[model samples]
Target chain A: MVPVFLAQWMKEKRSPYMVLIFISISIAAALLFGSNMDIKLKIDTFRGEGVTVEEAERWIDRLNESGAFIFSLRAEEESLADVRQGRSDMAVRLLKDDYRIIAVMESTNVELVQQHMQAVYHEEFRIMAAASHAEDELEFREAMKTYMEQPPLKLQSSTSSGSELRSYDMRLQLLFGFSLFLAMLTVGFRVNAMTAEKISGIWNRVILSPLTKTEMYLGHLTYSTLIGIVQITMVFLLAKYLFGFSLGHSFGMLAMIVVLYTMTIVAMSMLFTGILRTPEQFGAIFTSIVPIMPLISGAYMPPGTITNDVLLFIGQFLPLQHALDALIGVSIYEQGWTDIYLPLAKLLLMAVIFFGVGINLVERRRL
Target chain B: MLETVELSKSFKGKTVVDGVSLYLDQGESVGLLGPNGAGKSTTISMISSLLAPTHGDVLLRGKSVIKHPQDIRRVLGVVPQEIALYEELSAYENLQFFGRIYKLKKTALESKIQEVLEIVGLRERQKELIKTFSGGMKRRINIAAALLHNPQIVIMDEPTVGIDPQSRNHILDTVRYLNLEKGTTVLYTSHYMEEVEQLCKRMYIMDHGKVIASGTKEELGRILSSEDTILLQLDAYDDAFIEEIRSLDPVRQVERTDQGLKLIIAKQSRVLSSIVQSAERHSVQLINMHVHTPSLEDVFLHLTGRTLRD
Candidate 1:
């Protein structure tokens, strides 16, 4: 049975398809990283000449104390893409009197940069007034100060788009969810294939043999988990080596969680097969369910952003949410076993429930 | 020995197999004969424990298999009507997988796989993937996969349904070898009467979920002893010729077909010559003729008023 599974996996390898998925992820990551780099360079240049690190640090400290980091400028009005492309950190207005503070990033991490901009604001404005009386320096400064003081209730920040935590560890939540997805498909497809054989008559050969249902189920689950572990470990290696992601949380603990999660998925698949009699039905159900998973999983999108009350409610019952939460703790916070015990316990509890429900459903078919 | 006592099953409110009783002793061969929708597969499924009988019981070695299915399932091999081998795996790989399932240890399992592959005459092509195999090869491997464990009682459900004559003959020879040479009890099912007549010693005729008749080949054939079969090939067949053939001496009934006419006669030899004589008188050319003694197909036609193929 074990060899059969290995042979089966070898037959399904289709290495080229996997390579395509990997290439797509790499390309997406590179594009996002490049865009971030271009924005970083533009902000640096806007800080202007000979702004010493010490002066920047002092200015940043003041801005941090004041809890404000504002950017205001004026240029020929054009597309939002152009405003962003020139790598301007905020929206810029080139009014006759003064520029408007359309965007602000609260000084949380880079306070010194905010301070350097504030220090040179008045000097830059005065130099512009000397060249042309098209703008009043005092009035322009006052307008800019008022704008910064009020700073429109909502502020858009560049840091918000990326992983907000500087540590690579926090992204483990995404990796964990991805691992769960892999486990779901692997185990589910195997179970689907096996059940299809049962319905289509191949199982008769095995049924009359010494192999009991327990052995068949165990053999498949064991092989599926092994495959899942390999896939997950590869994703982690890629993250660590190629993408610089963290995985310092106890590998043992993560393995334990992953095993439970894999079992849960396997059990869920069994339940699905029991409910849906044919492979076509299974395919339909799997497709319908897979797209909705990432939302509950908080893999590509966080559960917090999901405003639909029903989806949020459903998210709590979903295995992905608990697994993702545990992942965030273990990877992001570098949490110890003590910190993760609660979420891990919940996951195990849910796993038990799913297993019970699934087994009951499948076994009931015997009647 | 394998037996089903009053075995019954229903699906979605329709009784698919009702009150079917059958028994096969050691080394005995039985064929199940029935038209389509006659519940042959359903009965086999119940005996194999692949299905739960709505009522009654199936037994192996005097122990009720429904109560202890694993005991029977361990020794009973079934070749389904459909090809059941995995197309993704090669013939050898499929046999090994099933061999392991039957808990054959490494050394013995290897020897047994070689043995079965040789028996099936596919030893040289064992490594070829099933998906790449021809239809006949696939059918042969399908049967070979079922024989890996050397089962005591083997049930083949319409195994020769859609195979070339050569493969069909190979399968029939294998069945004969398994039953006669190896003392394996066999339960075979098919709609084809000739295969059943060629292979089965005892047989059962089923229709609409009921076993209408069961006996030895001769005994079942004897059920319609009063009526013998006559075949007549003619240049053309018409209602008048059919009526004239029925009115002939010893002719009990007549059925006309495009090729010729079938006359069920009380005395087949007495009427066969007269039918040819009458065909010439009616300006009908007698192309060929035969007197078919009462066989399973006659018994099926007698019981159902429809041929097995119908």
Candidate 2:
């Protein structure tokens, strides 16, 4: 089977268009994993009239720990000029002895620096009350606990990873998805071609040759699968290297998933062959099914976002979706085999179903 | 030797090939001649093991190929009516593809590709894509691909359709060469009567999905020996004139050709005077006239009362 597939691959060779797509995908994948951002700590002294002294001190400490720290001055006596003149990374002005946390990081670092300050302040307060006076500490702890318990009025931090479940940018994945779709397309068309050859005049030429149906089927089937695999591999490697796309799964696992997905594609192609009479008819059939398949199977979006119950169920049935979900699961959650079993199982089952249908469609009939 | 025993096929409850029983001895060339939609293609499909006959069996070398068509398929070659060569690939690539499918050994397959390319007179153009080739060139390459596997029995289904006269003659010569020189059994199917008349020693005439007639051309010629054809040309004529001519006593059958009128007369007819008398009575300006022996076209006309095209 390997030799047959390889032989067919060498015979067809890759078209130039395919080579271009591969090169592009590799560049794109490399871009995803290479973006970087920097952050620093600081403090501010322009406290609003509503601020209290302890709140100001706590804010200042948080800045000292997580933000770029400059200098502090007493509100009544210390000169702001001395603090500003090369004394610190940032200058703080004490207003009524209350402070505000501020930072002068590059715009890219500002948000990250602010996020760290807030987290650090919250932690420091808990520690400070734990070490200070007992009865006062108890009272202070209760008050501080209540204050800490109060959710911030506007707690918007884009850098807070917990705020958003990070999803890999799907455009890159969709490219690979399209490759799988193309594989299925190839299979569908090839089936019609084979059927036409079988019934028309060419079957005699085919059969009289030493070629067996299995060999012919495999030869074409291998070409289709390899086309898909090559496209997928090219896209996958690009997404992996260019995008910094933590593919989150082992290379071997991803390869296995691609193989299963391609097998299912072959099966679907066979089904089309069995049902359609001509290449044009197969194209029509393929168009009718393929567009809907990507939509239902969550090829472009998360499965949970797909609204239709039937479509969702069907998506779960599609090996491509299952494989993608399993890949994402491994990548995002750092899941291992135990967590992957269900999607893997579903993929295998779908593969079997597809193969069975394809065999039934393609096997020579009695009459 | 290969043979089909009472092989029949029906589609959608209509029989297409009904009770076709024929055999070919090794190296013997047989032709299947039929009018359009005459089950010739369908029969060859079954005989090639591509389609299963609804009933009966195909026997190759005394073994039933119906249940095990694969065994028969191995030594049988088919050239279909439609051009089946891939337009995207070069001639050599296409042949190489077919070669790989046939499971030729790697070295032998390469050599066979080179050999078939030479035989088809396209070795220099082997690298040129088939889509770029002329219709005749593609046809030759199509035949060459079939020849690559060196099958014992070669089946060509209307192989010369729409080809230039030169290419058609070339294909005919190559087929004859393969059969006579290489000792390969040939099954040729064509709607063209002349191709069959010139090439096939044995012929089968199919109609409405059944073998209505089968024999040597001489044997089939005997079927219409009782009647002979006479063609009459006129510089001027009218329907009334043809009507009067059809009423002539010696005319067994009458039909109009483009330039003149045709008649089938009894074999013993000596009706030149009667024909001239009818022409004179009708005031038809007679230009030319001829009497000729019956042909396969006449035989088909006698059998179905229609032209082979119909």
Candidate 3:
């Protein structure tokens, strides 16, 4: 078993494919991080009719209360120039009779910013038209500001510790939440290699040796587990240094959850290896399945945002969801062992089942 | 010693290797010869214990290999027809990996790898990745990989296929050297009948999943002793003309070709006049002709009614 494991490592260390995979994962992490870091929602505003700088500032202040965007007032040309130059995220040119929005048509981020800016300005436009007097217009604006300022929902504490939930950057939250997805990418690579070996002529020679079926499965699985851990660990290290993302007081506990989650991923890799007939088959299956995991598991959304009970219930069973929950709970909420035991235990139980079934299937099948 | 007892294998109720039995004495090189899809590889695989045989048993030194495969694994090395190597790794690294799998430790493994590299003449550039090497060079390293642990029996399944002549010759010489100098038994399978004739003292010729003939090289050649093969090249010929040639006096059989025909004759001189008369009657113009001594190919063609490489 040791020799087989060592041989697997030696092949990876010597192969250019290994280097290519490392660079790809790093670039993927950096790209995901960069996309998150560079997005700043800026809502540029201008005065129109009775809409003075002071009145516009009031609306800007109202939007700023959410802390979800950067609000400012700029000239029509200057602000539109910023939009053209890709500096300011969005701009609005207000006239005596009507207002025009300026933004890049292509970017999805710009589209979202445009929608948010429209909601606020459209409300102001409606009130000013309905108000018939100067004081009435100002009074209506004030009422609308207060209405916007009101909290979306009443606050409540679900946990006993009463930890203040910090509002997270949506992209940053997803980047961390996808730690399992990112780790599984490397596991996918190892599974590809296993399929390649099985098809190659070397398999016959290796089978001629005295190695047992259990040893072969365990050897490849162990290597995959190590690779998953190492790749995920590298992403975390890069996050800490490059993004200043902290893992909080329970870093060790967080690391344990990641390792256990990685175990489940490795077992899944084995299961894929056992079921798929070829490397291309695994790749096709993986490409189809990879996006669906993060999609259905809510890795792309903020916690408490998955309002659908079915999605949340399904998330309970996904290892990625549990991993993200445990990571966020321990790192942001400063959760202790007792607080994280359920997810950790669920991940472990899934790991045992996956590994057990994977080994049993691979043993019975020639692959 | 390795012995296969009526080894047979079937897929979907169709037999690929049927009730074939053979043996390899210690330090002897035995060859399994057959055309493509004739079950040479299947037989070798079953013998190496890589594939399970249906309704058959294999014995290694009188111990049942089917029930206990590891008993022979310690002594058997298989070189499959396709390149069974990690092209990403260097030859030395590939050898070292296999040595470790064979349970060779430290100095023993290192020295054996170096020894095989020297033997296969890849020692100077052992550090280069196998993918960088030519087809023949890769084949040499493939064989070298099987020699690392110094197994008693080396099973080669067409290792020389698609290689340059020099590399093919080198592999043949190395197999011979291993048998003669190291006293390692070899079970060699091939498409090239000449290779088997040159390498093995005893050989089996197979087709359609069964050994059609098995004997020493000279003994196998005797199957063609009574008949002489006449190859006639022609300017023009057809199937009807071939049938006319087949009806010639003293002609046992006639196989059509691109030019003319291959006729098996009982007495060449007596049939020459009749063959010429038949060619004239069919208006088939003979360009060139040759008669040669019987070879293993003739034996295969005699028994299986097809070329060894067909």
Candidate 4:
């Protein structure tokens, strides 16, 4: 096994460009797509006939409090022109007591902004109504501040494990998504070397050696898995230290997840190698199919965004989706081993099944 | 010593190797001769334990290796027809890897690598990548890789298929040295009859997935010992004259050649005289006439009705 693995390493060392290129692409892609996730969406806000500039400014502050969408007060003509000229996706028209969303197209961002505005306005209106019942304005303000500080009805959200659900970071999702997606390519191509070796007769030469079949497979798979882990680690390290992306404090959990995910991916690649006849066919088909996995698994978007039943059901079978779930559970959610054991177990199970079936197919083809 | 007992293999109910039984004695160089698809590669594969025969057993020193292939794999070195070395790796690196897989000690492996390289005459170019080497050089390295472990038996399957004459001679010399000097039993397979004739003491001639004949070169030639091939160089011979030669009482077979006609007839027969008279009567010029001795090729043709390359 060591010799076989060393042989693979020696081959790669002689021509290290492909592996280096994959790592570079992973990091570059994460830097390109992940950088945008941190910036807040900017929406232009303008005053209506009865709304003063001060009131509109106050409304903008209220809307911006969520830190998700930034609402800026602008001249009515400027805001309307920006939307008309396609400079902005949407604009806000603030009235004295209500707000209107003016836009060229409808999108999730527009709907989310509207919902936030409604919630803010409704809370303010309720506070105003409560103040009207007070004897003096000063007294009303003081009592209202106290009540707001200690609200009577507080809604708390927590997971089934009784842990508070942490805020999800879209940047980390994109970072991990693109990194793991590209890592799959690295590991897959490495695994696909099996077929290439077979075609080149190197595989038969190795078989004729005293090495056992199990050792040969283990050697190849272990090397592939290691290459994948290295690619992922390099991308993550670059993202963390170079780009200043926070991967949470759970370094051990992250490492464990990386190993499991890499192994599962290697096994999955073996299954693909078994299905495809030649290295060329495997490269073409595998490359065409891998890029779609992240999309189906909702790796590009925030969780719960892809509501299609079919896509969701299919995503359930993909190792990437489960891996992302475990990774997010560890990094973003800061969940413990108890919380992530299911996804981790699922990954292990997938590795076993895929490796078993894949090796069988390969051996059958050999016969 | 090793032998296969009625070895056969079938793919999807289509038998590719049928009832192939052969043996190799210790320190003896034997040849398995056949054309493409004659089951030579398959037979070698089965004997090397690379493939499991559908029916039969391979015995290595009186033990069946079919169930325990490790027994044979330890002592067998197979130089596949294809150049199986990693093109991206140097020849030395390829040899090193193969040697390590055979569980050779570090120091021993290093020396063995150099020894094999020296044997194949690629010691100086060992550091060059296999892809950079020419076809013959790659082939020499291919043979060098299989020799690193110094197995008792070496199975070379058409190791000189497409190479320069110089490399071909180098490989033939290497095989001869391995068999004669090192006492390594060899099962050399090739369609090139002359290569087999030059190297192998005993040979198996296979056609249509079966051994058509197996014996020493001279012994196999005896199958046609009673027959002689008559070559007639003619100048515009007519079909009637060919029919006349074919009708001779001693003639067994007559085939038209580009030069003229070839006839298989009884040895010491008077057919050549009869043919000359017939040619004169037909006003055809018999430019030359010669009686050829039967070779192993003739035996193969007599038995299979085709040449070795066909």
Better of 1 and 4 by DockQ: 4
**Alpha-carbon RMSD of each model:** 8.2, 10.6, 5.3, 4.8
TM-score of chain A of each: 0.63, 0.56, 0.71, 0.87
Model 1 lDDT per residue over A53-165, tens place = 45444433433343234332223343244545744444433232222333345432234443444455555556466546636667765676678788878654322324344
Residue-wise C-alpha lDDT for candidate 1, range B51-137, written one tens digit per residue:
889999998888989888898877777888888877777888888877877778999999999998887789999988888987777
Ranking by TM-score: 3, 4, 1, 2
Residue runs of model 3 more than 4 Å from their true location after superposition: A15-40, A44-165, A169-172, A307-317, B256-260
What is the lDDT for A157 in model 4?
90
Best candidate per TM-score, number?
3
Instruction: List pairs with backbone clashes in candidate 1.
Output: A59-A115, A60-A111, A60-A112, A74-A93, A74-A94
Instruction: Mark the 10 consecutive residues where model 3 chain B has the least summed lDDT.
Output: B267-276
Candidate 2, residues B243-290: lDDT per residue as tens digits? 877787878778778778878888878888888988898888788898
TM-score of chain B of 2: 0.93
Model 4 lDDT per residue over B1-310, tens place: 8999999999889999999999999999999998889999999999998889999899999999888888888889899998888899999999989888888999999889889999999999989999999999999999988888878999999999989999999999999999999999999999898899999999999988898899999889889999998888988988898888888899987777779887888998887779889998899999999899877766777787776777
Task: List clashing residue pairs in candidate 4.
Answer: none
How displaced is residue A24 in candidate 2, in Å?
Answer: 4.2
lDDT per model vs. reference: 0.70, 0.71, 0.78, 0.89
- Residue-level lDDT of model 4, residues A245-312, one tens digit each, is 88988899999999999999999999999898999999999999999999999999978989999999
Q: Considering DockQ, which of the candidate structures 1 and 3 is the better prediction for this target?
A: 3
Model 4 regions lying over 4 Å from their true place: A40-105, A113-167, B226-291
- How much RMSD separates candidate 3 from the native structure? 5.3
Decreasing DockQ order of the candidates: 4, 3, 1, 2
Error of 4 at B147 (Å): 1.3
Tally clashing residue pairs in candidate 2: 23
